[model samples]
Structure formats: structure tokens, C-alpha cells
Target: MDLELRHLRMICAIAEAGSVSKAASALGLAQPALTTQLQRIERAVGGALFLRDSRGTRATPLGDLVLARARLVLPAVDGLQDEVTALVGADRIGQYRIGATNGPVAAGLVQRLSATRPASPVTVHATWSADEICARVLAERLDYALVGACDPSLPAGADGLVWQPVCVDPVWVLVGERHPLAGRAEAALAEFAGEQWASAPGDGCFTACFATACARAGFTPRPPLEMDVGGCIDLVAAGNAVVLCQGTVRAMPGVVPVALTGSPLRWRHLLGWRPGGPAAAAAGELHGLAVQAYLDVVAQRPRYADWLGTNPGFGAQPVTAAAVSRR
Candidate 1:
């Protein structure tokens, strides 16, 4: 429908906040201004869009479909604006749909990507699992996907693909301050094998990498209490369990990170995108910048350079503050 930009934003806001008044408050828009826009949108569609009730506004079955489309399309329209601006040299802009299994990678990449092209638009969405991200890239649903240091599972009927090694980040054990192992600089896996485990299981690499590290230490880890990064921190900090995460995980509140002893678990990031596609080159550019951002965050530590070293002659592009605006 030929709706105004406010109509789209109104729908998206309503969907997110679950109420028109809440959306209006969040947008700093008066309730009637938003109500009029919603009415216009619904009229254009020939029926009511939201099911208004005592609690708030909920999407009708039709409204839910429209809301979902608005979520995907409005950002895509912004992306189109970027691409057009870039073509005229008025901007360095493009739309990127990246699939990843965790938050830090998405957060850091957004920082660098926005820094690279401040005028360009970038949207990051989280996939519930790494396997889902991997498959999304292959199916062309995503422009690129970042896989964790992965197990060597092969594709059954793969033809053309480009897998660029991305970042190699140090994996650490997250523990409570009162825990016995926390005071030690490092502890062998066997030393903490019996501890209850908590982890983010969305990334196959993280799960396997940690579990394998535990197994190589000579015992199977009990089933983890799967949690998000915050819950993991809260659980571990309460002295209920031990968890593993990369360096940035230390940035969370209420959690202290400790180095692992014996053999350290090194996670190598893989940049997966379709080979020979137009995005392949862009994906490479993204990987280098992303790795640099991770390095910049952890430069004091030297051991986590494995994947950065994997790219031979990786200087395909020079990253600079000025270059961020140039794309």
C-alpha cells in the first residue's frame, strides 16, 4: 500500500511495544497522531489492523502478517536508500543481513560497520542457532554468516563456497569470585570437571569447543543449563555453575572471568558466504574489519591470533577512520 513512513513506523512500534499508547510514548508522539496514522493504515487495508482491547493493542491475524512485513521491509527500504546514495557517491551505503549465533559478534560488527560507513545503514539480527545461521547463508537468506570456531562437518553436495577464517578469540572460564578456581591464574579442565556447567548453546562451535575441552580433560560435562549471556553470568556469579565465553564476556556485570589452564581452547571464526557471489568480496571486507575490532578490544593478550594469521595476504582492504566513510 502507498502508506506514509509514519504508518510503517507506527505499525512496527505497535508490534514491538504491544500497545499504541506505549508506542506513542516511546516515539514522543501524541496518542491521537499515532491513532490517526493507524486508522489510515487500517483503512487502506480495508479492515481493522489491531485488535484493541482492555490490555492494549494486539495485531489481528492480518495485522500480524503486516507487522512482520513491516519489520523486514521498512529496514530494507532504508537499505535501498543507502544503496542509491552510495551509487551517487553521496554515501557509502548498503543493506547487510548478517546471521550469527551470539550477541558480542553482532554488537562489535555493528560498531565497526557503522564506523566504516556512518551514513550507511546496517541492521543485525540474531539467529537462534549457528546451524541455522550457516544454513541461512547457503540458502541466500543472509548476505553473510559468522560461524564460530567450528567442527569439521562437511556439506554433502556442496559446490561453490568461500570460507574465510575470521577472528581467533581466547576462550575463558567464567566463575564466581568465591569459587576455588577463581583465585588461581589458571586451572586444568580436570580440576573443574565436576562443576555444574552453564553456557550459550546457540553456537555449535562454542558448545563443541567447550565440551571437547572438557572431554579432553578426561570427563564428559553434565548437561548445561542453557541460558543467555546475562543468565549465564547471573547463574555463575551466584556460585551455581561454571561457564565458558570469550574475552568480551568479561564485560558483563556480576561475572568474573578466569583463564583456562592445560591446553587453552582457541576459537577460530569463519566467514561464510556464497563463493563467486557479489557479496563474497564484501564479506571479506567485513571479516577483516570485524577481526581488527576484536583485536583492538583484546590487544594486551597475544594468544588469540590464530584465525587472523589464517588469512594469507589479507590486506585486501585497508581499514581507517576515513575509510569507514568510504565503504
Candidate 2:
């Protein structure tokens, strides 16, 4: 009874679904069969990986350790399979696989790439984890990754990758049209001290960076409601909470994106890839396309473009040899 990749995947699915029955359904197996398999896995590992109760299932400490390793292993293994398959089918070698977290840049890049190279296939993989995107690039599953992180910090899992700065964007607030400050071009952070906050979930330093910014504004912020981008927009439209978003956030019907006075928090967009991978040959061209895409997104957001003119520090950064380095 040796632990295998399937076993690790089962463990992760159970933890994610929070119940064996749900996990079994998701994995297309009988509930009892899944339970038996879980029992065998527990025996092999010599411990109970999960604690089941009336509410739901939660991972034990041992389960946590197993899950961490599974996350790393699964991507690398999947990437290896992809690379092997691509090698067998040399015709697919010219395709561009772009990975990114939520933002307008990836979409813009894909559009530009398709227009410029009509014969080359372009695909975009979107995730909430910048580290996962970088991991996929390192594993050769993706040719390049365009991700954003808080200022002064690089994306995690970038040990052997080259990173180039695409732009520096100021974090802005999203408020409903009816909100008192919605009409203002800029609002101070302290103005929202008494309001509730919401934001999309991501694996980055933005959470800590936001908290520190709020603390400096002379008030402690409540734990923000973490949800997807759509959900965050819903909360703002309903006037239940305000959200923090990139300055280049698209215009919404009932919501407004307002810059924070003095730009207390900043986000840095980066383009990363393996040094000698397929993307290396066109790294300069790819980076230029990415920067242009960012500018295009900014252009669509008239208010943000206007704000950028007043704030020189918050737009595309100049790319130089100094800006491109291995992390």
C-alpha cells in the first residue's frame, strides 16, 4: 500500500470538497467505494488525514502537510505530461501558452498575439494564484506568465525565472454610484474608515499591504469579505461594501473606481518566463505587447487615464536591462 499521485489527488479533492460524499461525486466514484479507498490511504499514511463531523470534513495537521506537497507535485507532473505530448506532436510546438491571474492584460495580450500571428495558436490560462502561474511557467507547462503583485515583493515560486516589470498601478477603490464619495475624482483612505470592505481573493501580499495602508490611515480595517471578482462587483452595486481594485479596472454600470489620495498602496505588473524556453526568443516582443496591452486597458478607463496623468508614478514603467533579472 504505497502512496501514489492518485492517492494524493484524492486527498486534495476530499479536502477541497470538505466531505467524502461530495468528493466521491466530483471524482465520479461511489460514496462507499471512496470511503474504503480513503480508509486504505489512511492506513498507508498511518494516520487519520481528515476529521469528519456533522458540519463537514476538515483536514488534520497531517492532512495539511500532505496537501502542501500534492499541490507542488501535481503541477510539475501535469507539466511534464504536457511537454512530452507536445514533443510527440511537433506541429503544436509553435503554440503560445500564456498563464496569468485575473486582469485585463492577459486578454489584451492574447488579442494582440492572435492579430500579429494569425497562424500561431494562443491560449490563456487564468488563475487566482500568481505562484501557481509562475510554477506552471517553471514546469514548462506555460511559455510565459503575466501577473500582478504588491509593491516591493516578487511573485512566489520565481526561483529560476526571469522577471521584467510591465507597469506600476495604483490601487483604487470601487464604490456604488449612489455612494457619497463616488462622484469624487479621488478619495482619502480614512474616508472609508467606517465602511465595510470587500475584495477578490488572490495569493499575493495585497492583503497585508492593504491592512498596513489602512493602519497608517489611523484606523484598523475589518477582515474584508473575500470573494471572486464578480461577487465583489455585486457587493459594490448593492451598496453593501466597497472594493479595492486595480486602477485599470473596466468601467461598470453602477460602480465607480476612485483613486486613493497619495496612492498609499501600489501594485506591480510583471512578465516572467524561463530563460531558455520558447518564450525566450520573443521575450522582448512579448514584453512590448504586454505593455501595450496594459496601456490599451488604461485608455479604456478614462477616469484612470486622467488620474495617471496627475500621478506620474502610476503607469507603465520603462523597461531596461536593470529591470530584467532572474529572481
Candidate 3:
């Protein structure tokens, strides 16, 4: 008569794991709480549920009956959680304010309406850094953010936010068209060991990758000029120096994309937001768009902003396979 879902779950977990401590870890609950559940269940059922030995807890005859029923009920409960997740993903709220890193995400943004609702107040702001965007969203000043990684280390004290996968950005070593190493399908650290690089500030993954690569090659690549990411391609094209470029900047013109054969390196873009907010509805649509945009680019959609010249309407043309194929 005292049987309940919580009691059933604890008993099943204990029976399966064979130990209360192990069950507690699996359920993210405390061992004391799990033990309390077991004791309460035994009293309610009028029989001890487990045969405790030196090894661990095991199901008694009565416990076996309880576990069998639990095996069936637990799966249904798990199914319910899955359905709730789908329900959340499919939800569309009317209006919400938003912010994102200021950049063209291929043509992905084209998949949108003017606002979430009919005349519902919605604002979308664009900024320079992912941290800035995430901060605004966490502050409740903005509802959601579309941002690329900044600090390779995810910000600490980010309990107020939730994250979703966006895309993987490959960091390409960029060299001038006339550079001696530009002719190769891939670039090597030895080719530019003593050369200067245009590096941006931050411990971003791309920057970390480049530094590590250079360190392995017995050299440290000093920046010819430390500036914003936009300026690196210009420096590379002018032959001032080579800049280890991220996937985000590879598609921009005036730079050649050279793969690194020696090690693994990639940058990730992520969409993040607070748990509950007005923007929840639009955040879902934008999250899907961001993912699609990333996929389109990863499939070598070309036409990356880095390959675009410093002219108005430059990004209008996508980078053709033939263009990057020459790499």
C-alpha cells in the first residue's frame, strides 16, 4: 500500500547496481537517502528487500518481485522523460529578445520571419564576443545567444545558462598566395617556425591549437600585429606574415587554407540561453537554424567571410569548391 515511484526506483537501482553507494551515484542521490528508501520500502512491504553480504546488496525473494515490476515501470518513466524533451524542443513561444555574435552565418539567417509573433516585441542584438552575448542572456537582458567559442575553457559560474551544440569550425593555417608553402595541400610548422602570425586575444581553441603546433615545431609564432580577427586575413594576404586562421575566417578571401596534418584542432560554435524566458520560443527556431548553418558551412559551403574581399556585398557569392579545391 505504501509503494510509490520513488521507492520502486531506489529498490530497482540498488538491486541492479548491487550496492547502495553505487545506486546513489547512478541516481545522483546521496547514499544515506538511498538507504533510507530501502529501509522504508522493506517496512512497507512487510519483508526485508535485500540480503546484505560482504560483497553488496542482493534481491531477496520478496525483493525479486519488486524488482521485476520496477524493470517494467522504469522504462516507461524513461520514455516519459524522452517525450518531454521532444515536447520542449517542439515548443514555439510567441516573442523574445535575442543577441548573437555579429557575423553572417552563410545564408542560414535567411530562414526566419520578421518577428516571433504578429507585432510581438522582439529584439535581436549582435555583439563582438561570445562571452558578451552569454553574459547578456544570463543577465536576463537577452533571451538567447548564438556564439562561437572564445575562452577554450568554458566560463566558470555558468549555472544560469544552458548550452546546445552548434557547429565545428576547422582552423586553417593561412598563408599568402605567393608563399612558398602555399603550394602544398597542407602547411607545416617548419615552413613558418620563425615567421610572425596575426593572432587574436583570448585562449580560444584555434589560438590554442596554433600555439601548441608552433611549440611542437620548436618555435613560438609571434604576431606581426595583434588585432581583431577581421584584420588577420588582410595581414596574411599582404604577405606581412602567416596567421593560423579558424574555420570562421578560412572562407574569407585573400588567404589560402592550409590543413594541418600533424595534430587535431577545431573550434565549436554553441547556442546558449537561460532556462526559462520570453525568448524560449524563438530560441528554439534560431538554435535549429544555427545548426543547419554550421552543417552547410562544414560541408565546405565555401564563401566564408574570410574569403570575401573588403567590399560591400562581398559575401553575396559563396566560395566555390573549385576555389578551395586549388588548396
Q: Encode model 2's per-residue lDDT on 153-190: one tens digit a residue.
A: 67645667888888998888999999999999898999
Report the lDDT tens digits of candidate 3 across residue range 212-298.
666877788774455677676678888887776554553556667676554245554556677655565455566666655655554
Q: Say which candidate scores most in TM-score.
A: 2
Q: Give Cα distance to truth, residue 7, candidate 1, Å.
A: 34
What's the number of clashes in each of the models?
1, 0, 9
Question: Which rank order by TM-score, best down to worst?
Answer: 2, 1, 3
lDDT of 1 at 280: 65
The lowest-lDDT stretch of 10 consecutive residues in candidate 1 is 318-327
Could you arrange the candidates by lDDT from highest to lowest?
Answer: 2, 1, 3
lDDT of all predictions: 0.62, 0.82, 0.59
RMSD of 2: 9.6
- TM-scores, all models, native as reference: 0.58, 0.76, 0.54
Error of 3 at 258 (Å): 0.9
Please list all clashing residue pairs in model 3, or write none if there are none.
Answer: 93-281, 251-307, 252-305, 252-306, 252-307, 253-306, 253-307, 253-308, 303-319
Candidate 1 on 96-125: residue-level lDDT in tens? 667765634566777889898787567655
CA displacement after TM-score superposition, residue 166 of candidate 2 (Å): 1.4
